[model samples]
Target chain A: MPTRNDMLLLTGFVAVVLAAPFLFEPIGAGYPDLLQKFAIFGIFAIGFNILFGLTGYLSFGHAAFLGVGSYTAVWTFKLLSMNPLPAIVLATLFGGLFAALIGFISLRRTGIYFSILTLAFAQMSYNLAYSVLTPITNGETGLQLSQGDPRVLDIAFGRDYGAVLPSSDLFGLEMTGYPGFYFCGAMLIVCFYIALRIFRSPFGMMLRAVKSNQNRMNYTGLNTRPYALTAFIISGMYAGLAGGLLAVTDPLAGAERMQWTASGEVVLMTILGGSGTLLGPVIGAAVIKYFENIFSAFNKSMLGDIFSFLPESLQSGAVSVASLFVGEGWHLTLGAMFVLIVIFLPGGLMEGIRRIGALARRKKPGGGASASTPAE
Target chain B: MASILTVQNVNKRFGGLKALDNVNLEIEAGTVHAIIGPNGAGKSTLLNCFIGRLEPDTGTVIFDGVSLLGIKPHEINQVGVSRVFQTPEVFGNLTLRDNVMIPAFAKRDGSFRINAWKGVKRETDIEAKAMAMLENVGLARKADEIAGQLSRGDKRRLELAMCLVQEPKLLLLDEPTAGMARAETNTTIDLLKKIAETGITMVVIEHDMHVVFSLADRISVLAQGTVIAEDLPERIKGNPKVQEAYLGGAHL
Candidate 1:
């Protein structure tokens, strides 16, 4: 949150971000593209947090819904028009429907086994999309638009149904880069607000109840499986929406996007930012997307040039060591981040921030929060 | 008075041992009934059966007009029957208010929903009811304290608060003062007496003869799986059959 004060800070931060392309457009960081990816992934991570963070259900197959959504959105383009809005909605629906079916079966188990089931299903989806579902998914090369795209509505309107959108537009409305950026940004805000609402709701309390002491929830006459399943479905729907947005922004859908590795990336994002904390997943999404887009852009030659003034041997070694932190080897950094977070800070980075915040609060008089309070 | 609750032909076997054999009893409404037994007399088993926590191999547990076999514990509570477990199964992670709120929530919310948009404050009059229940059991000041941090005496009071919050017609307490200190035990006995005066029918399983004598309007003494005698406290205290089952065997 940036607070009200924090929100003002964040709003200012976003304003700076929106202006970055104009400020540093000469530099090819693609500030607009970077911001778009951040907002999109932020939505995805927030959805993941609801399922994994709040409910304590570790899902390893979330990528399937994301994939399902992407494929659905692309299919809409192939069958209807390349209108991004319709594709997004249709993709979200397809993702949620797919999730409902999987959640029904997987939520019967919990802990490692539950995670394994979701992972197995996700892998199965990946394999099928890459091969067996070739007719629909277009296989390894991935699904894309063709001239035969039967977007009847677009064709009836005397337009090419399968063509790529011209940056952005609406029916007689001008939409360019900033409008598109604000579109995704507002969606992210909506997603964050919804997650915050659920966190404070009685339904959210029941989910936590299901997480902490499931048996007690059962003994209290709640059929616990239904609650877990519902949460699973909702989270799956979220993944689907994120996937739809990805396809919308890029105008392509790929099997690799739905891989187990991608699923693992989401889990990493949620935990690194802190599970069970409201803004943590969004923060995590932004951090990971930034590193992926910006950090990886630095290559061995760039590193070599930066350290050219150093001795020749030390300069080359610096490139090697820095390369180990990014590019094809970036996962090592991601993995180490998770291990350190799990061992040293099991409550995640959010708890660390909270502790610091508490310390600052203690320096003020009468600022000690009551320990026994349960949030309503 | 016609019995409002009945446990008929109840039998439970754990491998080769018969924990309860053809146990039968009838409990009248508004009476404080006590089940006194030796260590292995299946007092807890009978209590568990009555509460639908453990199914008996053979039995009919009839509460009011409904069969108690397949009903959940909270559903049973909804039907005006509730049990306090032997070890006081309080929610350790919650406060005393939250602990009481749990059973009260069960009564109020129908156990589950997807009310993700509704605020907790507007859910019901839960906070006021939970506070009043705590006040009733003398735990009002400690309502905000974590239940796990409570003293044993306070824990017992907390458990009693949980059971009573639902306003059950039949309240079952299993050894409510089992491990309490002498002072705590007496306080529990006094509390039970005060509760009984309110006309809430109770069935208690107590090993403490002093507390049992102080509370029971009628006592059923069990030896082996079946009741050896059911009488007033004075008669059960002097019965030779009870003497043989307990006094002769050096059992409490």
Candidate 2:
């Protein structure tokens, strides 16, 4: 039931995602690892937007589901086969179940109180996974696949890995390098389609109604709790799927994945890209991940080399100043960018794109008629 | 006609000040019953009790043979009651069509359903009905406009369309013409008259005498948490108690 415009948007988005390697090669983000991170986090942010953007419920503990997904996926790998399918499915289910529990309790309150409750629940999960749940989470050492572990499914199928550790695979194709990126990319596309459908569904309207006026919704004979809770669970499953993908790319589950900072990262991604609009979260995720991987890799020598054309004194001074905003200090750049974006483009990158599109249309003669169409 | 709503021994108190002092009333089906009172006369409090917004200290509110007390607001709504707030509480962020379609979906799918997979645009029947309701309220031209951008009177009409789409058995309106200009008020009156002809029961609380007298089949005058007079609209205007409580003995 997607409109022609929606179908065109989907096709354009798919083309760009599939061509990411070629498109990003000149920017040094063409590597499989960063591309995989972009796709995985893109899924996470899209899910988070479903709840936060539509319903105006800000959950600060979504990383708990992500961590749960990682642990579930790792456990699936250790106990069953190295196949990513079972691992991803179980990870998504556990993530949703955990979200149902947390959403049920946290949704009892709203506004700042709801945010704090989610934070508390997440902090509790982080601590439990870091300490008390050592048997399951492996505590400080983290959970990793080992040769000693049982792979019942693989053994039943008569497949064996003698000395070298087996990586996650689909059928016989190893999910690493470009294949890993493609795997995550496929999942991201499917998730985006589902998110798009939900946005155009009756359920999405109800969520928006919840944000608009809860009193009216109740008076209109629509229960807002179930709607909010369903959004929460759906987002949680998305985070879980992202986590499972993370495990597939690199078969390790660490307690740090459940930390509050990780939860905050997704929020920043959503806000930076545009919380409510389709395609914004993916862009935001890519921008943040790009900064984390590429910007952090810069050193003083790299800055000096870039400023080599300047005089000796000017080059040294530039390096000294520029070094503070890169390498380990790359967060300063991100913080400044976030501040500027919030001030100038409060609706995030999407607003900026819309304004530029508007400006371009205004410059073109006879474009006014089509440009005046209302934005959804 | 049989009564659709009955209230007995309803009492509510806000600390020492009584909001409703053992109020009682019955509204027959298919009639426009107007509750007119001065400011702070507990008319809203009484209406709140019927809609499950407030529970009275001692009372039984029977709507269509079902007790309305101790139930949720949505449960009350599900039992065939719909309310339009005094300030026109429509979904401001949604389109007018979406605003009307939400209640239609709620009515068809009960209180909760996960109709997530189907496209909202594909529900052609509901879309047609919602559009027709908007057209009935003379808002068909601005169907795609955001509800928040509407004028005060237009928003009120939009809210009416939203409620009418639900096809509720009873509609409760609070100050349907409170802030409207004279022309808008007349238009609303005409719309209400057309709706009244369709045979749905309505309970309206209004401070506007012109709206009340023009549309009310029966009138109840309340003052300081007590009903002083209840009769046909023309008869209630002559009652000395109603005159004293409402207009301070001024000739009506």
Over the stretch A185-267, how does candidate 1's per-residue lDDT look in tens digits?
76677677677667766677677767666655555555677778777877887788888877766667899988999999899
- Lowest summed lDDT across 10 adjacent residues in model 1 chain A is found at A166-175
True contacts kept of each: 0.45, 0.89
DockQ of each: 0.43, 0.87
Please state the interface RMSD for every predicted structure, separated by commas.
3.8, 0.7
lDDT, candidate 2, B1-252, per-residue tens: 899999888899999999998888999999999999999999999998998889999979999999999999989989999988899999999999999999999999988898888999899999999999999999998999999999999999999999999999999999999889999999999999999999989999999989999999999888899888899998987788987886777775
User: Compared with the true structure, what per-residue lDDT tens digits does model 2 show for residues A270-292?
Assistant: 99999889899999999999998
Off by over 4 Å in 2: A369-376, B247-252
Q: Which stretches of candidate 1 lie over 4 Å from their true place?
A: A1-30, A156-178, A306-309, A365-376, B94-96, B141-156, B178-194, B208-211, B247-252
Q: What overall lDDT goes with each candidate model?
A: 0.79, 0.94
What's candidate 1's DockQ score? 0.43
* Clash count list over all predictions: 5, 0
The DockQ score of candidate 2 comes to 0.87
Q: Largest DockQ belongs to which candidate?
A: 2
